[model samples]
Target: MSGLKLEQVVKRYGATQVIHGVDLTIEDGEFCVFVGPSGCGKSTLLRMVAGLEDTSDGKISIGGRDVTRLDPAERGVAMVFQTYALYPHMTVAENMGFGLKMTGHPKAEVKAKVDEAARVLKLGDYLDRKPKALSGGQRQRVAIGRAIVRGPEVFLFDEPLSNLDAELRVEMRVEIARLHQEIGATMIYVTHDQVEAMTLADKIVVLRAGRVEQVGAPLDLYNDPDNRFVAGFIGSPAMNFFDGTLHKGGLRVPGLGDVTMAAPRNAAGAVTVGLRPNHLFLAEGDSHVVELSEQLGGVSYHYLKASDGTKLIVEAHDQSAPKPGSRTGLRIDPAKAFFFNAENGLRLR
Candidate 1:
């Protein structure tokens, strides 16, 4: 229900700094996700926002109140961790109301809040059941319900669906999305899964080595990345990168049968060319060898190795798949290609 802000937030351990000076703003009711690879400090940043970790130097504010020095209990934020830390001895209803009960809320008020949370999480039927008696998804929902009863200003999720099976993960993702829609509360989620960020977030913050890589909508980052890391990290299967030489008239790529294509404006010397799997297709002559083909019902992924030993992946929607070791050619869509400076990996406009 309240917006959150961080100004020059920083975290350090002795001589090593894990979180660099970061500035961010989350509008009220916006669902923001932090995504990156392991050891990128995404979880650490989230924990700092929750007041579970101390900030080495910086300022954090929630709903116009500075909470950088406050304890976790006073931050007006509820965190749902990766593990469902439910009490086995207590029933679903009791667990959901325990916080309020311990805080001196009356029995009738606690009961009403617990009931409302159960109804919102669709756990009304399992109120009397213990954590051991419920399924994994049910237990997770109970944990979420516990948070819901507190009525926090912001919700923090730290890979809450990591323990569930694939099917259950998908199911819980839909459930969480619906929960956000109904409650309309500001949420900050941390995960290493870009797919989750793509599906769940209104805005995504991509991190690398404790530095902010990019911050934008999921598709915005995917479609137009500022650097090579963001471009490579945002898409599934990753984008194929090739070494190219920019000449007077065009760019020459040795991996693509030494093909020459139109170069971008102001680009010169050595450059990197990037192409997505869906933008490259199997063509007529043999310039590459098929390594493997993965058929996934609706689409197939063809893994190929060019004569220069460069690897590439092509996504094909048709049912036919070429056999391994078969020689083939590739056709890349010029309009969809991306050019980057080879030395620094910055996009060339």
Candidate 2:
């Protein structure tokens, strides 16, 4: 029952308010991720839950116990930060057991806990190595092992993989995912990397300007977004958009031409058409011209612009991807099209 709940959470610094009233519930053993662009208050909200930042107004409960006013150590939560934060001179085992030692745990008990964590994190072979002797991923693992030795009810990670190289980031992502699956603990991870959010989270909390935009499972948010922001932010290449206005049965995009949308006619004023890059395909009509092609081995992405100059991206795996400045027709299944209100950037559904 180590779930977490936040009710009407708010944070303010003098007259400037951040982290608006946000209500969320993360069930026990759920891997929840907080993701958004920089300065979007994702980290701030996570810090608040960790008792590192004060909540201006709200109630925070972990395992049903109110912890908004409790000190960090008293809240029974362990946090792993972006920085490794390990003791430079101490061995891995010593670093992992330091907290328990400081709290006066018996040496044997500390060693036992440290040994268990090392086993879990696959750090048994490097237990005697100092922080300086480990690779970036290994150091981060040691940091995670340090947290595991504490046996906290919940684990908080703040951009734990931001420092790693691309390949290492992917490696560590899998490692963390496996760790969560093996331990089945309640975990909250924060990152600006959408790939990390998509792959690691059982659920995602997308924030903006200190307010929550959407919260749902990764693919749920990807396939069904609440707004333009959520649709655009959750994917890798991102969802493509074009400014349009309601016409007879669809919206008329100046550059993309007329597109039949599923939005209610009564809800229309100025509208936007959202087409995922993966959904667009090459057709035979002269609708667009290829602007650029990004080829990455087996897959390629063709950046195109309509005759009217509305830009779009099409995901193509064909080796003979369209060349730059080549004319081509693009089409999408009518059922897959997404519409948003141009004024508020909200989904038209």
Candidate 3:
């Protein structure tokens, strides 16, 4: 059982506390990701798990073995950092085998491990080349290969694709996913980009303000968010929120007029209505004006604003669409709508 477990983990830097009472579990061979905004302590938590940072409190166990006080070398974990801190002067083969060589492995043994890692990473052709000769994606693969050669029980990646170009990042995402399927090693990855979190993780831990907010599969988090923050942060272009006053017959929105809605149990007064951009559609009537249109080949996103200045994004699939600045009516499927409490941002349903 090479799984990871954390119990009431906390990290404090002098008088300020950064990570607070975090408890989590990463199952063996699971690809888990820690995602959040800057200064949210996602990286700090990952570093603590790596044994790079000391645990101020609480227990950490890997494979059911207590490793809270263990040094990084003794923890059976390998980390791939964001920066490709390769030795420019060393060939790919040498770079991959350097750690094993230093640890006094026989030359033949080191060579075998390096060779296998190279083959796994598709870096066999580049083994003789220096780091300077490789492209961004290749260098990253070399970094991963370096970690693989260590034969660690778990792999930790700290935003390893942040430095790559957009196209290369996508390419490397596929490479990493394939590597995980082939090796089936327990993995922990940290990143602020939700898109990366969505695409790469088998499980995602969403953190905010040094505390974990939610945990689930990617689509689970998207389709069934616990609160407004999780809903807004997990989706691209974000979920649109409109404030309104609830009445017996309908909800009164400031800019868009009253919308008839079935009231929830004990629901009344101030409230917030949540609508995903994809759920909104064009209708006949002139209640809203188009602000802009973003056409991305096959699909388009129309930005609209009501007379009272409430903004919305409506995703339109057809090429023939309303022109910018045109007035139109909008309709939402009530079944697709999400309701949230205006006071605390918690999902009402």
Top candidate, metric TM-score? 1
The estimated TM-scores of all candidates read: 0.98, 0.97, 0.97
Q: How badly does each model clash, as a count of residue pairs?
A: 0, 0, 0
Indicate the worst ten consecutive residues by lDDT in candidate 2.
257-266
Best of the candidates, lDDT? 1
List runs of model 1 lying over 4 Å from the truth: none
**lDDT for each residue of candidate 3 in 1-349, tens digit (9 for 90 to 100):** 2899999999999999999999999999999999988989999999999999999999999999999999999999999999999999999999999989999999999999999999899998999999999999999999999999999989999999999999999999999999999999999999888998899899999999989899999999999999888988998878888887777577776544456677556555677888889898888989899888888978889899987788989887878678888998988887887778888888887
lDDT by residue (253-318, candidate 1, tens digit) is 977767998888868679899999999999998999999999998999999998888999999999
Q: Pairing residues by index, what is the TM-score of model 2? A: 0.97
In what order do the candidates fall by lDDT, top score first? Answer: 1, 2, 3
Clashes of 1: 0
Tell me the whole-model lDDT of each prediction, alpha carbons only. 0.93, 0.91, 0.90
